[model samples]
Target: MVSSISLSIDSDLDKVSLLARAVRALCEDLLGPDDQDAVELSLVEAINNVIKHGYHGERGKDVQVAVGLQADQVVIEVIDHAPPMPAQVLDKAPEDTFAFDEADLADIPEGGMGLALIRMNMDEVEYHSGDSENRLRMVKRIAPRSQ
Candidate 1:
């Protein structure tokens, strides 16, 4: 199956849920239940990040989120007007797993985990920011059907 959808809205946090619904609808026949949840999780994280970090909670900044379904995978794209993130941060992948060490638990940071969640949930995550717009793309591979 193949399909695509896109949404452009202001950076208001209230509208984030709308983006999630659009993504879910796009993946209706493309992703299985588990994969659907992962896509929602990752997409939400990206939308929230754009609202928080990209627009700094301005609420009026423009942002766009899109989803495309392929025969074997789903692709997600997010575009925003905020400045680009550092190359190092964008290039780095999230840790394979997240487990807190009891001894250092108190030192754990408060908010830097969105990217990790996005990377962990999606099969592939990429970003590019330049020429006045920043783009984030994530891909989730569909599981094979049982024989």
Candidate 2:
């Protein structure tokens, strides 16, 4: 069986936490306790990117959160009305550009590292943009193998 829920909210950093909490609850219930932290952290990072880069610091734009459970996997998607993330952004090697220090965090640039964290925590990550919408989908595998 598959279960899903979606919500649209203003594009704001503060709102990302709410999205994370909602997604985490769905994942925990559907996917079980294993990797719960990883799922929550990934969702938080993805929602942060949707608010920051996707919306380009704009206010009152819609950020959509969708969660789904199918068989042994949990999928979460964050959709925004803004243009898709640059291919280079997603393609870049996390080791090279995502390494951040305290100084870097203090002077946070317009972009860096969030997607890297999302990639690291999720089992699969995909991005799609067309028809005036951008979608970032992440999947986590959840199932126990019998010995």
lDDT top scorer: 1
Best by TM-score: 1
The lDDT, on a scale of 0 to 1, for candidate 2 is 0.80
Error of 1 at 91 (Å): 4.5
| Tens-digit lDDT string for candidate 1 (49-147) | 988877789988888887787888899999998978767666554662345564797766566578889988999988887798988999999898888
RMSD (Cα, Å) of model 2:
2.8
Off by over 4 Å in 2: 32-34, 98-110, 145-147
Model 2 residue 59 CA deviation in Å = 1.3
Cα lDDT for residue 73, model 2?
Answer: 89
1-147, model 2: which lDDT tens digit per residue?
787888777988877777777777776655656577888888888777777777788889998888888878888888888877878887887776655575766755456678877888889999999999888899998776556
Candidate 1 structure, TM-score to reference: 0.89
Per-candidate clashes, comma-separated = 0, 0
Residue 137 lDDT, candidate 1, scale 0-100: 94
Off by over 4 Å in 1: 91-93, 96-105
